[model samples]
Target chain A: MIAKPLALSLLLGALAVVPAAAQVKIGVVTSSSGPIALVGIPQKNSVALLPKSAGGQSIEYIALDDASDPTATVTAFKKLISEEKVDAIIGPSGTPNAMGVINFAAESGTPMLAPVGSAAIILPMTEPKKWVFKTTQNDGLVADKLIEHMVKTGIKTVGFIGTADPYGDNWLKVFTEGATAKGIKVVTAERFQRQDTSLTAQGLKVTASRPDAVLIAAPGSSSVLPETTLFDQGYRGKIYQTHGAALPDFLKLGGKKVEGTILAASLMLVLDDIPDTNVSKKLAVDYVAAYEKAYGTKPATFGANVYDAGLMLQSVIPVALKTAKPGTPEFRAALRTALEGVKELAGTQGVYNLSPEDHSGFDQRGLELITVSGGQWKLLK
Target chain B: MNMQIVMLLGQDGVTNGAVYALLALSIMLVFSVTRILLIPQGEFVAFAALTMAAMQSGRAVQLGWLVFALAVVATLMDAAKVWRSKGREPWPHGTLGLLAVAALALVLTKVLPLDRIGMFAQALLTIALVVPLGPLLYRVFFQAIAAAHSLVLLIVSIAVHVALVGTGLLMFGPEGGKTEPFSDAFFEIGPAMIASQTLWVIAATLALMGGLWVFFGKTLYGRALQATAVNRLGAELVGISPDLAGRASFTLAAAIGVLSGILIAPITTIYYDSGFIISLKGFVGAIIGGLTSFPVAALGALFIGQAEAFSTFWASSYKEVIVFTLLLPVLVWRSLAHTRVEDEE
Candidate 1:
């Protein structure tokens, strides 16, 4: 009887001890069901494709949905840090949602990988922002490439139409500065809500300005509207779009109207045409293939943003493991340090070379100039 | 802005105004008859537009299944209510009819080559699929609590709207869709060019409003509905069923909502959650009408559309702010104009 009781107690104690030291816990928060669901759904789905085991340690992810509400994102971050004790956290996909959780993640000493568009999350490098890293290319980097193409094409004047949100505000700021530096004039700047039923007024105003080219800055499929409206309004000037319009739906929705539209986005769009030697090309292809196999559709670049976060964690976990054990404050700090030390780490979006001052360390290699030709994304040679 | 710009903006405003006018009428009709705010009226618009887009893209429309599911739940609730009132109830004929309508719609979607069918047939099929949902929703969510306070009803309406938005996301996914235009032709008037789709929207709205006018003025059922809207107890004493009035008004509201959706789908890209803002504008119009006057509501919606368009031209970022601010003056005027206090029964 004594032997049986002792054996049972031993078994219970072993079961409890094994899981605590065996797995690395990571929490994921995504706005999978609200206004920004266009960006959040894919990121939520990509959580399934993240590496299950990294650096010989099994990983467990606790995923939560914030419904695109900023307050909900903060609550989710707090719960993940205090209740689940995750070593790292990924997502809360919208720029606004990601911006809301920086202080919480910093207070908890947890590393956060935000897959949002704005560069403001890491720019100026505050103490709180140092703990946050962005997965997507910065608006300024993409804007520079666009400005280069505009100069090459001898475009003199450009009209700007963007959403009244952070994504558009940041793009406007960066594009205005870059265009002014390059001697290109921005004639008219207009804004619209994502849910607006019509853009005829904005389209008319932009067309009346009579710029050589018009640039539309909005995220997801919402970017297709201003262009289509412009096309319908008899504006035949060249149209330029931001990386936000890089999704396949842009082609499907714009159809024949979007022909000759220029943009700068990730290599994932032209994976078939990109050189095989490119650092991120192979990984992007593999990710696309795996996602298609699992979901029966190609993954959007937004999903790849989350998957790249997984890749970053995969590379840094081993380095952090040498310093401290998982599920502790020291381990999270070590993970943050290891992430900052990441150099020439290729992800689906781009190569990440993080530093103490720059949390979103990406250069020109991160984005490519792309255009729509014959209803498909084509590399602009 | 020049004359050309003014004319162009005015044309855009008129097109959007017609759709908003239809929404305002429906909202007023539903509120007057059912005493419910009908917040999810916008979901009908979104569902119809998305269903039409799905048909055009050759995807199997999932709205039929949603209608069928709502029907089943509603039928079960009705049967339970009947069993409680009278120990044993016979087969539910009313529910059976709704189920058959849902099943037929499902079968038609599967059997018809939706993409190849002409736009008219596709639209008719979408209307058939989406209209029954209004009555089913009325039955499932509102009939039992029909006697609740207006605030309670508004709260329920909000919940239904949120639930439908989530269901819309699950059914349609997150991408916005736009259908092919009815015609690519444009007519130039002076310095402005108006697309044929704009004319179609205006014509359809006029026809719908005319039909409503005739229905209320010339038909006995319409007068009965009017009576119920005016005095529920008096109508009930005269043997008019408030339940039938509620169903009829919801049916009318759904029809208007779907037609509005079909009209606007080609002119703009519409997402699953786009209907709330559109309907909110209609609600603003309804409030302007004091929730009773149809003509005033329709005119109010038109004013909103024009104000919104001009504001977009002047200060695009503050378009919504300008349009919604119009409501404050109207509300103040309405309060001063009507000082008689009425008590809720």
Candidate 2:
């Protein structure tokens, strides 16, 4: 009788010592509302679905809505760290907003994982934060993909219309570099402030050059009409738009004009449509299915990245608790070490190979070229 | 050399020029009487149209447009009464009254929960709020202010803009704007390939311009406003209060802005700060017309709009590069020429 009671007590003690059986806290900040509300809504949905997708340890989500603003993102990050006391933080959606948090995230030794932001600020900064990791492909990959597709499609001469912000600046640089590298000629490139009403000058100049295709980089709904005017004016050249332009809101704004517009998007968009039987694929599918069942609309790239981002952080906390003592820099570093060592772990999006040099962790091949056929995304051949 | 290419450029210019003329007239009429460059004229245009569209933003509002138009006119009338009542009313006399009306309506317009922003909703909201507003405001706020010199009113116009933007920020919340195309009720016009809404804009703007030309050149009331703008005190000494003509001018200017708002609303998207941009472009157009010539201002708006399309069609970035390039050099040359004439005067 004494032996039986002692064995039961020992079993309970062993369970308490095991790290997998323990709960972990992680903070997430993303745009859940505002003009870019459509983008943030998806990320928020995907984040909630990640733990259920993982059959093992349950993750406690501390989601803070940044309202898609940079200032809000900064404040939320501080709140999440001090008030929420989250172990690690994930996401600050837009490139501009994400850039605002880089210095603070590194200084506080709070390891941050950027899900979908893509500007030049996170990496190659004067003070590169080794603690920071990004999972979303940036302008370079998008531009390179466009150029490759253009070259293959025999689009020698191309024109561009872009928004006038840091986002547009990155687009111009990457697009030009990619086109030049691929031996494609640039006909003309024009920049406009976000508020400008007409794209006529830029449109006319580029159309006159006889470009085989036109590339647009504007971030908002302003460029849609000028884009449509391209067809109405009888410029039969193909149009290749960036992933930044791949917004459902654009279709609503642009109407029939967005019907034929081509865009580069993440592999996650076509994830549900594709055939996959593996555990990771099954997990992602089941997660997406459950998420959609709970919330009507299918999970978008924003949600998918954050969901994977949560999973990535979830995997890291166990190693952080295992090899070292809690509340120490050594423990945080080892956790960071474990994250960098992440390889062959099939994520919701794809196999994430997070390394020191590669923060996006995926290459150009990870993306797919899709077009709006009859107002729905169709795989482009 | 290419016929299709030529047609495209031509069509683009024509459509752009029409919209610009309406905007120019709206600003020019106000400027002539008030001698105040109301830079936020475009915002008025956008707001009225946006409000109207937002009110009837579902499937095509077969009879909604007429109802919206009436509502706009009534709101304008109320605004006129409020402006006329200022100084005689309970509130301390100033722009505070017009600011209150504009502020209240401005917020109400932006916060509407429409699934898809219909054609011209932004423009409509701007116009509806501003049209009746100008007369009311002229009586309450601008009567004494305009009695000052033309240049002073110009500077004060900056205050007007500050109030509009600040109120807009407070009420609507900061978000960019968007609108659904009028493709649902769209029927192509031979070569134009425009929506029924766009065609409606073309027709109404043309009719309004034709009517305006007749009224200004023929009507007695129109002549009185013109006299007031030329020499305010002299006009009052003759018989007209100059203040009364100022009221008429205010009404006409607001009406002009509203009409343009209606036409332009169907074509483009509207944002909270869209007024500032519209004001700048319209100013450039007015400058092209010497800022005193309605016909010239109207033409300038059209020219600039066409030039934007032309540049965007041919340009690499498809932005407004050509308009600025053309505007800067011409403005410099015109400025020098005008200085020489002023020196002689």
Candidate 3:
């Protein structure tokens, strides 16, 4: 009796230690706290809301919350794959995080897609890691639109407030080069970390220089944008903040002052008038209703991104399941191949037309200028 | 000095430096009196601004004047009691207390129709609440963790700040409290910006310094504090309780920090990490002054502030690099090394 019980206990322990044997599980990882946590929380909700039954398969999600650390992102992905035995993965979480986790996908041949990774990360990856894909808008496209807006407004001689991270820094670099080429004086370029609370040090410098208007290439963190607070403490100037500032969290936390704050976001979100070609309005109503039903509050842009990421994963799973099998390398490759066919899919933003070269899925036309008018977003024509 | 350089320097660095100096003094006062560094000095700044924004008073709560006066009086009484209990009668206690009161005065001066209280008032209110709030912090976590080593204490204190900040983030949301530009003040000095808010912080810091001089050099308890700092056991023999010294230090530090918060908040903008940054800069100021010399620390702050201004003007993006570079030479010199200031009385 002792031998039988001991053997059974040993067997159970081994099973627990081993990767769960060949059950269809999709791994999802994203940040959940710190400055990015505000955005990350929505991403978590997206993973949680991924349909329980998709394509007649009971898809199980191996979810991990990265908590905004690059180190944590890799570790979380590793846990989902090795321990949870997830057949496929969805993530990159953000640009830096996306860049950080590529090696795992590269080496393990575990097909992965970066839902929110910058285009730079996806563009640079070689054919070997063709499994890697991304869904975030490109900084170059954002920069192009920002430049166009500045040119249209006849606002010359602008300044850029950059962050220390790759996300904001990349956008700032592109905007700076683009704006400078357009004869706009790149007055001042400064940086602060995503976690930094006060932007006064930087704002004071930028405003003192007397830039015509400030173009903020900041991350999507409430703590990082010192522009609104700077305006309150007496720095006055026109602002063209990035999509990072587009979230309602910025407006809600920033309050009244967030009015007239100009930012570019994916098309079809919060537009007063319907766009010529879009689906977010039709889907937005239902998405908002469903989100409210599920989460009690209207979902943020971050939530929408994650929710769409789940949907994207769901779409790819059907095509992949046809060719891929449980515990097979061909299965992961098939999943990767199926994801590449994601063309002209109507996303919350606009039609995401993805190809080998076009990883961001949408271009400048896919975005629109959102002005916070009367405490709500009104997309400018 | 070249006028061009001076103008640029003033424009680039002076306003922020003024605020940094005030925060540094708050940190030094706590160290000078209690031989303890208040880690929550920054949180003090954050809370004051947050409270200022939240309360939007001077009229909302009835008899705003009374609540303001009571808060000031309570501060004075608390500071006074701590001093007297140690038989030192901290004369500067009321002066520092008054600094906190002035912060309240700022909110009052701006208070109009309840809804009309602009964001700067909210900013000032943030500074005010943040200022006194730090003392309450001493009554919390670190009071028990005081016996830990300096690094451990620092880590614990930082952890406390992060936890408090995170809690604030959850409650307030990522959108920071709104602030309006301080109205009714302008001290134009060439290219650099000096508004009522900046001027207020500078005045508060300087006045407190002068008051501190009187407290230390001219008064009985002030002298006792010096004695207590030098030799606590000897102070007791001569007549001073060590416990009083600690409480006085905590109250004085909080009062000073509140003034710093109030003075700085309007110009700097009240955000969750606002106070923490001030504390960091203040520590730098203290270190530059060898942590023992008040006048030296103040001077160090001014020099650092000016340098910061100059660096920003000349090398806007590399301003931090310049300040850190300045610290390197200061650090290398033995004369600038930190000296353990004996806290007696």
Candidate 4:
């Protein structure tokens, strides 16, 4: 009688463990505080809105804060993969943090969906980056559009002022290549720290070069300083900013000084004005309405990248679940394959069509030009 | 470079150097008076700037309440100390002055229509709220350990700086702030047009330096501060209270920091921790002067500003490296030239 009871108990325990292992886990690492919190907080909030279950399988998300640090990002990634045994990871916003973990994720066969705005993270689709994908539009695509606008407006020479970090280096490379390809001479390349209080020296140096147009390549509020200084010094030339200035606070802080500044941003920023036929229009409207209803404020463009990553994972988990159990290494590989096979899926930023060679799946159609007219972003005609 | 370029660079450098010079002077003052390095000096700059930006934007800043609370804590501490000493010393005059300043700040922040006021008045209100924080900080954190070893005091200062930075994040949030230019008029000087704000920086720095010169050379209190800085124990023996001098030095440092913040906020976006690096740059200038001579420190800071401007033009990526690397050679020379004085154990 004792032996029969023991066998029945063991069978019940074994049955419980099998179903628990089938529940899919997704890990997220993003900066929720510190200097980059402007982007991180929104990303964190959006991830919370993801559906709890997909295709009859329960889904669990484990989100961690990286504090906008590359070291913390790596630590979070390691803990999630090894300790939590998450099948896939999303985010570690900012280019440097995302790039820091790409190799590890690829070598470990754990799929990562990075939400930063750098193309270099997924470009040249090599062996190490095969497991890594990004949701934001590529910097190269945005840079090309900005340069094209400049060329059309008779801008011959341009000055570039960016931060002295990997993000800035990426911009320098992309903008330089894009401008040079368009036959526009980049007269001066000046760099500043993101926390810099004054860019007077940089302003003087760049203005002295007398470029017809200047690209203030720093992100968020840091971008305003160079432009304001150059304007104050009486450099009456056209200025272009990157998509990083999409947040409305950039205008509140910049005030009247930012008026007339043009930038290449995702169409989601001005959802009402986006062409109805654009692939991203319906997705943008839906996202804006859902996000506004949830957060009581219009979502930042950076948050859209995180939301898109969530959608990507939601679409892939069902297909991957059909092949293998959730916690096994084979299941992680299956998820990676499914993510790469994603096709014609419309997201808030653009329609993602992932492939072995193109991880971002965004092209020139992903961005639009907008100008700050009267404390509002106006779509360029 | 052409004459026009040279003029523009010079203007930029001088304006930046003037702000650095004020910071250097304040650092020198605090170090010589108390033997404690004020590491959070730059935090005061950021706090003042953000507070002003908030006030100017029609937001009722909490700085007034913060100052009021600190003043209350500092006053109670003073009262307790006096009671323990059997009321031998009269109720502290500095405490009374702080209470008065705090009350004024409370009224100004609460009663005044900050948005209707001009930028100048808004800046003055910011200065008023920020300046009293200095002596209050001294009373709360340093007064009890005024005679502690310089290294210990320096550690405390770093702790204070880190704590303030955290608080700053909570108070100001992570987003950076920029204020409208105090004056938008442009004045053409020789080959370049200079913003009037730059001119204001130069004028304010010079005026403050001159005021300091007069105070040191003429007044009894100034002489007492100088004497205390020269020989702390001796000045104490001569009946000049070291506590008073320390408080005065901190007050002056706080004023200088707030002034610099107000001047620079319109030109650059300032975040919470931005002050620490700016302070480090000023410390470099102070070190070049051996932290003693005001003129040499001012000159060193000016050189740093000019060098930074020129370096950005030549090699933008290496500007900070160039500014920091300058300290190495100067430090080596100072060590070789001056005889080391070991502290008595």
Best-performing candidate as measured by TM-score: 1
- Docking quality class, candidate 3: incorrect
Local lDDT at B265 for model 2: 52
User: Per-residue lDDT tens digits of candidate 3, residues A1-381?
Assistant: 112222422231121121333256777776655556656666666665665655566677766767568898899878877776677777746777877888887676687767663566777758655767766677777777878888888988776777666766677667877888888888778776553434555666676677778887765544335666457446566788777666645665555666677888865357546654456566556666677787676666766766666667677777877876755778777777777788767666556676766555776656787777887778776
Per-prediction TM-score: 0.96, 0.68, 0.77, 0.89
The list of candidate 4 runs beyond 4 A from truth reads A1-24, A50-53, A56-60, A276-279, A282-299, B59-113, B239-241, B340-345
Q: Judged by lDDT against the true structure, how good is candidate 2?
A: 0.63
> What digit string (tens of lDDT, one per residue) describes model 3 on residues B1-345?
356346544643555666667767767776755556666777666655545544542323222332243355445555656776796654433335634554565465455453465665454544444444444344334444444566665576666566666545443433344334456566657644455665665666678888988988999877877887666568879868555565566667766765665555444335555567667767788877777777777777777777766655455457667776788788778453436553332
Return the TM-score for candidate 4, rounded to 2 decimals. Answer: 0.89
lDDT by residue for model 4 over A1-381, one digit each (tens)?
A: 122223322222121011234388888887866668777867877776665677788888888887788998999899989998989999888888988999889878899999987888888788889989999888888898899899899999999999887768889998998898889999999998887666777887888789999998876667777877787777889999999888877788878777899999888777778769987798778877887888677778888889889888889888998999998899999998998899998788878889998899887777889998888999999
| Pairs with steric clashes in candidate 1 | none
- Ranking of candidates on lDDT, top first: 1, 4, 2, 3
Instruction: Please report how far candidate 1 places residue A23 from its true position, in Å.
Output: 0.8
On DockQ, the candidate that comes out on top is 1
For model 2 chain B, where is the 10-residue window of minimal lDDT? B59-68
TM-score of chain A of each: 0.94, 0.83, 0.86, 0.90
Model 1 spans > 4 angstroms off: A1-22, B87-93
CA lDDT of every candidate = 0.89, 0.63, 0.62, 0.84
Candidate 4 local lDDT, B111-161, one digit each (tens): 888877888888888889999988887887898899998888998888777
Candidate 2 docking quality: incorrect, acceptable, medium or high: incorrect
